[model samples]
Target: MKKTALITGANKGIGFEIGRQLGRKGWRVLLGIRNTLNGRDAEEKLQSLGIDAVFVKVDVADPDSIINAAEILAADGTRIDVLINNAAILEDRGTTINTPRGLLEKTLMTNTSGPFNVILAFLPLLGNGSRIINISSGLGVTADMKDYAAAYSISKAALNAVTKQFAAALAGREISVNAVCPGWVKTSMGGAGATRSVEKGAETPVWLATEADSSLTGKFFRDKKEIPF
Candidate 1:
């Protein structure tokens, strides 16, 4: 049986690249997107490259959407070998002080609560040896730096905490749950001046998805190197 992976926000950006890489490796990749049209476009693109890709609607910010996504996947009746929680929004690209409260709440809802919503919704589809990869960022590190992007940074930090808690809870089941910090990459969100390419950014998450030993869980990784929590 081919291994299966479901990646959220995979219509484009790092999620798309990660899907392509994993699909090339022969995993049945499920590309989750909030918009069905965009998801179909991504599905078509991957299909043209001979990758086994499918699209499912998943808006991580909405609990109903997350539940529906899992229900759609449940029809397959197959276990998910990997789940990449890659959907996030950076509402305030700059100037944290000037950002509104509503923006911060929405950002937290999407960035922090979104992935956790997906995981909890799809927990039944995972089993022993399954991998859960949370796409986080280096900016989330409160101990290191905090100049701007307060909402995104704080939400990601909370995400890392969620990752740790899940890892501990699922350890006995042989499921590995960890967070991957993809460096600044050139995407719509990352912008043109970004130094890293999408391929480079997707490397760590893809690596964690396929290569890391099952024993390593609840850790932070950037390009395969474990980083301090």
Candidate 2:
């Protein structure tokens, strides 16, 4: 049977590119989006390109939404081979001193807690040899931490920790869980001046999802190479 992958925030940017590439590789791609209209549009676009793509309504920020999506997949008996936690937000680019408390909380809610909740809801569908790719960032690395984008950075750091915890928890099950930094891609979150293209940004995650060694888990990666967290 063809493998299946679900990518949150898959309506655009690197998430969309990951879906497209994985679909091209003959994997069934589930486009997880908050908006039904956008998800349908993305699904249709992928289908137009001869990809087996489906739209799954998922709002990672909302626990109910994540649970609903998991229920839908469970009802369909969808066995997810890969789960990409690509949904994230960069609400405030300000320094730690200037970033609002509400913005930090909101950022953590979406980027960190949301992925954790999704993983929990869908854990049953994932089995041995399954892959979990959490989209993190270089800013999340404490060794190279900076002051800018404090909210976004902090959330991603927490996400990396989540990856490590899950890796340990799932070690006996043979499920691989890791984090990848897509680099400074030219997405809405990365802005217009970023250097990398969406395809380039999606490459590592796609590789991790399909081609990386199953034995490899609980690591941070960038450009298909391991990096320090």
Candidate 3:
């Protein structure tokens, strides 16, 4: 049977590249996009390239959307072998003490809670040997914590905690949960000045999805190597 991968926010950026790479390898790719037009466009583009790609509407911030998307897949009896939580936002431009009133909470809604809900909503689709990859960041590393993009960083740290919690909680069933820091890729969020290309950023994530050791769970990675969280 062909493997299936579901990537959140896969219409563009690293998420899209991950879907492209996986699709090229003959896996069925599901683009979890919130925008209908963009999702259809992405699917058409990938299809033109001979990739097995489909778009499923999912707004991570809304539980109803997530549940609805999950229900769609369930109705089709689809099994998600790889689930990538790649949707995130960076909305800070100042120090933490000077941060806006609802910045942290807003960021948490998308970066932290979104992934948590995604994991829960799709847990039934994942079975033994399934992989769950969370797109985290270096700013989330407690040892290297700084004030840069405080809300985004803090949310990812919380996400790392989520990864570890799920890793331990689901280990007995042979499921693996891990986080990846796709270092400063040149995307809309990373900006043009960023060092890494989209392919470089997607390398470790694709690896974790397709080639990593099944026992390697509850870890943070970058460039295919484990890093401190």
Candidate 4:
């Protein structure tokens, strides 16, 4: 049977790269885009490469949109073999003390709440042997060297916590829940000066999706190496 995969915020950036890679590997990829125009563009781009790609509008910050998408998938009785929660946003890259409440809220809503929302909404769609790959960041590592991105860091840290929660809840069901730090890639979000390319940045997520060991669950990876939880 052809494997089904859903990639959130996949219209572009690391999400787009993940879609391309997974589709090329013969998975049926659902690109979860927020806008119809961007969704169509991404679908066309993937189709040009002869991928079995479809676009579904999913605004992570909007619970209604997430619910609707879940309803459609549930109606179709679709079993998502892989779910890549790659949708994220960077708001106000500023110091910890100087970050405004508005920026923190927006960042948490998107980077933190968004993935958790998708997980809850799509829980029924995930099946035994399924994989949940959360695209996280090194900045979220509270044990690592601290950064000034108060909002982004805290949001991802929360994501890390959520990853563990899902892993525990899904463990008996034989589903694997994992998180990966894509590193600073040269995407629009990562900026032109970022060290890594999209391809390089997507390596860990792709690996966790397709090649991770069965023993590895509820873990964090950076560049294919497991990091401290």
Candidate 5:
């Protein structure tokens, strides 16, 4: 059977590129998007490239949406080999002191809690050898923490904690849970002035999804190299 991968926020940016790369490798790609129109457009684009792609309506911030997505996949009897938690929001670039409480809450709702909810809802479909990749950031690294983008940084840090927690919880089950920092890529979230291209940024996550060693779990990585969390 062909491996299947589900990527959240795959309508555009790094998430879209990850799905494209995986599809090119003959993996069944589930492109999860909040907007139905964007999801259909992405699916068509991937199909035009001869990729087997499906659109899944998912709004990561909402638990009901996540549950519904899981239900849809369950109804189809689709088992996911890889789950990429790539849907994240950068609400503000303010420092911890300057960031608003509401902004922090909103950022965590989508970036941190959203992934957790998705993981729980889809856990039944993920069996042995399943890979869970959380698209985290260097800004979340505790050793490298600065004052910039405090809300986003905090949310990702919490996500890293989630990665480690799940990795430990699922170790005996042959599941791998790891967090990846895609670097300063030029995406909608990273903006145009950013340094790295979308392909370059998507490289590590795709590798982790399809090719990384199974022993490499519960770790944080960038460019396939382990980084300090």
Candidate 6:
């Protein structure tokens, strides 16, 4: 049977590239976007290439939206083999010390809590041997800490902790949960000076979703190699 993959924020950027690559590999790609129009366009783009793809509307920042999305998919009896939490934001342009009020809260809502909500809401749809890939960032790595995108970085750090928590919680069921930093890819969020392409940025997440050892869980990865969290 063809496997199914669900990718949030998959209408564009690295998320879209990951879905496209997985679709090319014969996986049923579910484009999880908050916007119906863009999601349908992405679905059509993939279908034009003879890839089995569908659009699932979801807004990770809102728990209600996520819960409703889960209900719809469950009603369809969908079993997700891979779940990629790729939706996030980077609106904080100030340093941690001088960060404005509400920026961190806003970032955490979408970046940290978003994945947590997505995983919990979709938990029933995921079975044994399923994979959960959180598209985190090098900015989140405490070992190589930086002050750029203060709120965004802090949110990713929390997300890494969340990954480990779920990995341990689901270990008995053979479900693998891990975090991946896609690097500074040239996406709308990554800006124009980013050195990596979307294809390169999507590589490790795709690997974790499809090729990585099922036993590898609760780790951070970049370029398909393990890295310090």
TM-score against truth, every candidate: 0.98, 0.99, 0.99, 0.97, 0.98, 0.98
Query: What global local distance difference test value does model 1 have?
Result: 0.92
> At residue 207, what lDDT does model 5 achieve?
93
What is the Å distance of residue 14 in model 6 from its true position?
0.4
How do the residues 1-229 of candidate 4 rate in per-residue lDDT, one tens digit apiece? Answer: 9988999999999999999998899989999999999999999999999999999899999989999999998998888999999999887677888998698899999998999999999989998889999999988998873758889999999999999999999999988999999888999889999999999988888888888886689999999999886
**Clash pairs for candidate 6:** none
What TM-score number comes out for model 4?
0.97
**Residue range 34-90, candidate 6, lDDT tens digits:** 999999999999899999999999999999999999999999999999999999999
The collision pairs in model 4 are none
The count of backbone overlaps in candidate 5 is 0
Q: Global lDDT for candidate 2? A: 0.95
Worst 10 residues of 2 by lDDT: 92-101
lDDT of 5: 0.95
The list of candidate 3 runs beyond 4 A from truth reads none
TM-score of 5: 0.98
State how far residue 8 of model 5 sits from its true place (Å). Answer: 0.3
lDDT (10s digit) by residue, model 5, range 20-123 = 99999999999989999999999999999999999999999999999999999999999999999999999788777989769988999999999999999999
Off by over 4 Å in 5: none
Residue-level lDDT of model 3, residues 155-219, one tens digit each, is 99999999999999999999999999999999999999999999999999999999999999999
lDDT of each: 0.92, 0.95, 0.95, 0.91, 0.95, 0.94
